[model samples]
Target: MTKQIEESYQLAKQRYAEIGVDTEQVLADLEKVKLSIHSWQGDDIHGFLFPNQELTGGIGVSGNYPGVATTPDQLSNDLSKALSLIPGKHKVQLHAIYAVTDQPKDLDQLEPSDFKYWVDWAKKEGVGLDMNGTFFSHPMLKDGFTLASPDKEVRDFWIEHGKRSRAIANYFGEELGQQSVNNFWIPDGYKDNPIDKLTPRLRLIDSLDEIIKQPYAEKNTIEAFEGKLFGTGVESYTVGSHEFYANYALTREKLWTIDAGHFHPTEDVSDKFSAFTPFGKGLMLHVSRPVRWDSDHVVILDDALIRMMRSLVRDDLLGQTNIGLDFFDATINRIAAWVIGTRATQKALLMGMLAPIKHLKEVEINHDLTERLMLTEELKSYPFGAVWDEFCVRNNVPVGTEWLKEVQTYEKDVLLKR
Candidate 1:
């Protein structure tokens, strides 16, 4: 078994070498990672998912950015042609949330034909779909969901669609189950000053509870909340990491989705992952490169900070993963962008896979090294790190001169540097 493992490692080293990874350093790092990660086998987290509509180039859609806006007729044809190009069991998301179709009164206006068409596209392409909510539609939700019009009728309008979406998922069945109508990215909170308007946020959370507890929210249907730090208003409900957890705490039904670019503009990616660990909630990580304050969604992986995050999630140190490509690359082909993002993400994971074997030089900094891993006092105060560290030490992790030096140096100097 050891020989077979060594052979596999050698094969992986060769593959990395071919992909421009420094194989010698990576192989050495792989040894350390193996020691650190041995007991983490049998984990259910595996594979990836991309948006099917993204695979379709501008020719077949009606929405915004990258692709040209077309009528539904043109969108249908474009989507059909685009579906033919995809390969494998990739996770896809519905771009229909941005639809400005004729359905202002009813959000369920996106019927079985709409969903079934996407599913069929995925079926033909051998892919799966990850559904997300829309903000532009529902006419009444122009400002945001939680704080849109502050009118009960408007809130109910959105909620009614939530029910319709669940029903559509039922009609579509397993295909939809493979992904989910992932929600709770509620545009709650206020603009101007960060005060006032607490009821809307609470209402949004309650609405999420109803959505998740309904018949559609199954084990297969993993509902997720994308915690946005900004965009909707000055004070969003799920902005800070704690707020995200608090929202989830309301009901133990669903998990939290982490968008790497959604924190305070200067927030570290590694720190973000640490915040979500206390709940040990299954994470849905969105992979995208931020251009300055704006989310460019470029596919470049040069930033070491983002790469370190890639490593942590790949290592499962952050727990069960549901990583997705959240790019909105405007210049390139969307399919190519998705592929590039996935490839870069895989590369980062490979680097992390090599971390257990790398040296871990003992440092005498002012604070404990693990202190850096703590996102909040709550997560650090919890027993999470102790259990994780115990697992590492039992495996005889090296005490000094580690290759993570490369990772840390790169992250600190190149990636995190503003």
Candidate 2:
């Protein structure tokens, strides 16, 4: 090989090693699968989480587990136990704590008793939490989090939870190395009336504002606004539509999240989904498999949006986003559910790695490229799902045949060691 190619190959190996990529072992393992095609070579490619730092890795945890611990102590103990089994490459994803269905008179105020379950849960689990309160089971906010609550008490209650959540995260982060939290599914737009005033929207703004005003808000903590489409007749904050929110009365330094499943989709436009690019800033990513027009959060690489997300991540417009499978599989038990969620994250990591490696292998290349240039004009123009599937097949990774079994083995043999 030429000197330039030899140097590039060595650089790739170094980059892979720095990012904790098991270059020699992975190539060997892929060969053992005995596929006809060769695995891609490691080269002088750069590993990225943001502009400069290389990410060690991340892992994911479920939000909808059954019979989870409720108290702080129980939560702390159980979460630690549960997370001990997962690989450290993924960040913990939470559904956040649910509010009491029928809150008693004295239970009106928000307290640690309700949130301690999650605080201890996160502390012991060694993972961050995804605050998914805007759309869960809160009787008071039946309509939605900030958009639906007509009662002052209800609005106050939501804000209180936001504060409590941040406080717990801040407290835990000082003790731990990382502090992570993201506000997802804010769904604060109108349903029936599209012409509503900015009052309800301001309430949603205040929810995020509460976190920013906190003493530790700016520390290691991230508040990602997850937008979504409301019901059939309802209109809400559409994905890729944050310019209006930025101009709102109570704007702050909040960032946007790209939930793979939440993007607006049609049979025709599914391949061309919008991306989140905040003039090159830290990002929170939501990864899932899309089934049809709606968000099934399926396990298979049914959509190419996953690839689209990886390119943005490679470009340094996003960083350190929590990834979790939001789909509800009625057939699987709780343990099985976690396994499924874990696999989705594993797949996402593999996909993210491919973007830069492919970029580095170009015959003629440019490193100083924008997202539009790198993602569209430079990289393969086809959907990423196809590429991911092709790579798995070529490497004999085995698809659609209970991939979770191999994941379980790897977790036991590799991850649980440390």
Candidate 3:
């Protein structure tokens, strides 16, 4: 199989070189791309902080496929398995609730010390870290509003949590030598059309301003804001619309997150990347799959994903983007979910990187649209999969469905035991 992979890769490389696409450089560049894989998928986001709390704020992780991680060691073990299967060294994204500690601490009172377990693990594994403020599934999420809540106390609780999250992200960066991207996503909105919408947006702006008032070194931690179109309950109006965060990110000089699932079904996030890149600080993409709305299904190598990744590669926006996976589907084996989604994302990126984009762009610039369309359509049938297989082999992971066997073995020997 190894020989077969190398043989196919050699032919594929020759094919790409014929079209002026350097497969070697593409692999090297793709290997440098590190995705921030979300940790909540292993345990459905019911972190150690409040294991019994009912998930709220319109977030849902369906399916009861057994062997959900019940402890820090288990989640870390699951993540380790995932890392081994994935091709490149990547960052692990953690929410505030995933803090590993013996002493109990509320979200508002969380300190960097509480997450020592993760930092230590990251050091041992040689992976980077990213942070998130969990705005859902908390008691303080009063009236389905947090940062934008009319109630002052409710707003205060989340504000403190946000501040603490930044400190933790800074600590992660300091420990791991990578700028921890601290993403803020609040589930604050109204299910029914509100009588007054302006007030909530105003309050949210002020709360966010307060949270980011005390600055940290940009090298240690970068801040971002994510806004959703609508959720299960908040179907009518979401306070943090794309427009809201677009302007906010521009003015505040913060990364604006673009979650693929956070937009209307008809809207494609790929188009916005170019529009935002010229003005905003940068982008943090939550590569996800949405069936009809924000369903948070596992990502697949679909057309939308292809376009988004191609846009990034073609526009040369990779350096200005923080790529991350954000999907939680408990219906399947949790470990397999990570492998499939992450691998699919990598495949999309690989396809994009392999495209003869320079030639295509030149043709377009010369007003040769017909030739541009011809090459692009013909390029789709190229042997990029051979190159992708070689990438996995070089990275020392399974090249194909062979990785599934390892995941199945882990499920039987480790997960089912729980």
Candidate 4:
């Protein structure tokens, strides 16, 4: 099988080379792209801090697939298994609530010491770490609001949480030798049309300004704001709309996260990448599949994903973006969900990298309309899969459906017992 994969890769490499695409270099480049794999998927967003508490602030993980990790160690174990199947060393994204500590702490009281277990685990696994403030699923979520709460006390608690999250993120970067993206996503919005919308937004802006008041080293941390159109409960009004953060990120010189599932079903987030990256400091992309609303489904090799990745490779916006996966599917095997989504994203990226983007752009520049259309359609038929298989092989991961067997075996041996 190895010999066959190598032979197939050689043929695919020759085909790509003929069209001015360097298959070897593409492999090398793709390997270096470290995606921030969100850890919530391993445990359905139910962090150890409040495992029994009902998920609040409009957050919900559907389906009751058994074997969800109940502890921090279990979550990390699942993540390790998923990372093994996925090619390339990557970063693991953590929320503030996932801190593995014997000492009890709230969001505001969290310190770098709380995440000592994670940092040690990351070093052993040879992966970097990313961080997020868990704004939802807590007692502080008063009346479906957090940072935008009318009550100053409620707002203050979350503000401290945000600050703590940044501190921890900076620590991760310092300890692991890579800048951590401290992403802020507050579940602050109105469930129905309120009489006044302006006050909440004003409060949110002030809360954000306070959280970022203390400057952290840019090399150690990159702060980003994520805005959602609406959520399950906050379907009527989202406080931090896309427009709000677009301006905020630009003015503050911060990264704006473009979550694929946070927009309308018909519209995808690919176009936003081109529009935002040109003006803002950079972007943090949350890759997920949205079925109808902002439903965080597992990613697939669909046209939306292909276009998103193609835009990055074609326009060379990768360096200005921090890639991350954001989806939770409790309906399937948790480990398999992580492996599937991450691998699908990598495959889409590989598809984009294998394209003769320069050749297509040259024709477009020359106004050779017919040729540009023909070549793009022709690329779909190319042996990109063979090249992708080679990528997995070279990285010492299972090719094609081989990884699924390992996942199933793991489920029977390790997960089912839990």
Leading candidate by lDDT? 3
Model 2 regions lying over 4 Å from their true place? 1-89, 98-130, 142-151, 197-199, 232-251, 267-275, 278-280, 316-324, 355-418
Which pairs clash (backbone N, Cα, C closer than 3 Å) in model 3? none
Off by over 4 Å in 1: 1-88, 98-106, 142-149, 169-173, 176-181, 194-197, 232-242, 304-309, 313-319, 357-418
Question: What is the C-alpha local distance difference test score of candidate 4?
Answer: 0.91
Q: CA lDDT of 19 in candidate 3?
A: 92
Comparing 1 with 2 on lDDT, the higher-scoring candidate is: 1
Candidate 3 residue lDDT tens string, 1-418? 9999999999999999999999999999999999999999999988999888999999889899999998999999999999999999999999998997778778998999999999999999899999999899988998899999999999999999999999999999999999999999988888999899899999999999999998899999999899888887898999999899989999999999999999889987899999999998999999999998888999999999999999999999999999999999989999999999999999999999997888888899999999998888988999999999999999999988999999999999999999
Candidate 2 CA-lDDT value: 0.42
TM-score of each: 0.62, 0.59, 0.99, 0.99
lDDT of 1 by residue, 102-164 (tens): 333235465545566556655765555565554332345544443234577766666766665
lDDT of 4 at 26: 96
Which ten-residue region of model 2 has the weakest summed lDDT?
35-44
lDDT of each: 0.45, 0.42, 0.94, 0.91
1 or 3: which has the higher TM-score? 3
Q: Judge candidate 3 against the unseen true structure and give its global Cα lDDT, from 0 to 1.
A: 0.94
Ranking by TM-score: 3, 4, 1, 2
| Backbone clashes under 3 angstroms, per model | 15, 11, 0, 0
Model 1, poorest ten-residue lDDT window? 35-44
lDDT of 4 by residue, 1-418 (tens): 9999999999999998888889999999999899999999999888877778888887889999989999877888999999999999999999988988787778899999899999999999999999999999898998988998999999999999998999999999999999999999988887889888898899988999999999999899989999988887787898999889988999999999999988888885898888888788999999999888778899999999999998898989999999999999999999999998999999899999988888888899999999998988888999999999999988999999999999999899989999
